[model samples]
Target: MKKILVVGLFLIFACGSESKAQAPDAVKKTFQAKYPGENDPDWHQDDHGYFEAHFKIDGIKYRADFNADGSWVETETSIKKKDLPKAIKDVIKDKYGSEDISEIEKVDSASKGVFYDVEFKQKGKNKDVEFKADGTIIG
Candidate 1:
């Protein structure tokens, strides 16, 4: 009787570990299809227990949020080369006089007005500058 109980307990523990080790295959498949070209993206559980895909496309990174059951909720893409505003370009060139500003992005905030965010590396220290649509520094 003791041996039988031990075997049963072992089986239960093993099954639990297996379940924890495996994510829902259906969820992974759906996520891959939804976020077409994301390479080796990481899936993280959000507050609502949904999975989010953090991936890059066309050299621009993005975060695709999906529901717990594998349904897509929303996607946020970082500022891409083709999406930068002209006002931001002038400001970055002038402010960071000697630095090479690699990328500039115009981020549309839901609450605040549109802003220009610039990314540059100065003396090996990465810096991000946020400016208003009119080229005024906001951050």
Candidate 2:
């Protein structure tokens, strides 16, 4: 009886972990078709009920989001401040001259199109600013 109980508990734990790590088949297929040759992405469900695949390509970290039905939503990659367009850089320098930039990411969204997300720390709080390639603030 003791042996059987131990084996049953081990199997339960193993199955639970496997299910948590595995994404739906549709989501995996879409990700593979979109990002061919990329494997072993860390998957998690986001707050918006979307599945996010976190992976790296050529040393740059990237995140790709997909809907439950396997539809692609967006992909984002971090970028350096210098990599931002000259217009955006100028605007940031003018408006946020006092704050230091903490992070920058280039986002390609299905609905909103492409934009840059810039983060700044002001008064011990984090502020995120979204800018278009032409330096227009959209969000």
Candidate 3:
């Protein structure tokens, strides 16, 4: 009947509108605008109607994604220099006698607190160490 046809048409339009609303640029712009940073968005669409964006804003890197319905999926903050724990740096200085190290990472633990993981090259040997929050060796 005429009612069935109208309902079908409305459903089609509604679905189309929903699809349009999930565009990657719209999500990226929303983030950039709210955060006041550059728009660096890389979008990926999957079978589950999810999209992901890897971007950096205000010197901090982030990965943010949205679902098909334009809702936020998740966000992961990138580790930066300022986020490194001081204990790890102290351990490197004490053990290696030099502060020349790379790939310093700080990992947070529930009970053990924050730990520093780093890679150091010395005397032709590459060493990896883990230090506790208070500059004590945990590895």
**Could you tell me the lDDT of residue 100 within candidate 3?**
53
Which portions of model 3 miss their true places by more than 4 Å?
1-58, 62-86, 109-113, 122-125
Q: Which window of ten consecutive residues has the lowest lDDT sum in model 1? A: 15-24
| lDDT of the structure predicted as candidate 1 | 0.65
List the candidate 1 regions with Cα displacement exceeding 4 Å.
1-42, 45-61, 64-76, 80-82
Models 1 onward score TM values of: 0.44, 0.80, 0.37
lDDT of 3 by residue, 20-130 (tens): 333555566655554465544656564466665666666666655566445565555535445656765555556776645655655543345556667676677767777
Candidate 2 lowest-lDDT run of ten: 14-23
Ranking by TM-score: 2, 1, 3
Q: Any residue pairs clashing in model 1, and if so which? A: none
CA RMSD per model (angstroms): 9.4, 4.8, 12.9
CA lDDT of each prediction against the hidden true structure: 0.65, 0.90, 0.60
Q: Output the better candidate (2/3) by lDDT.
A: 2
Best by TM-score: 2
The local distance difference test score of model 3 is 0.60
Worst 10 residues of 3 by lDDT: 16-25
Better of 1 and 3 by TM-score: 1
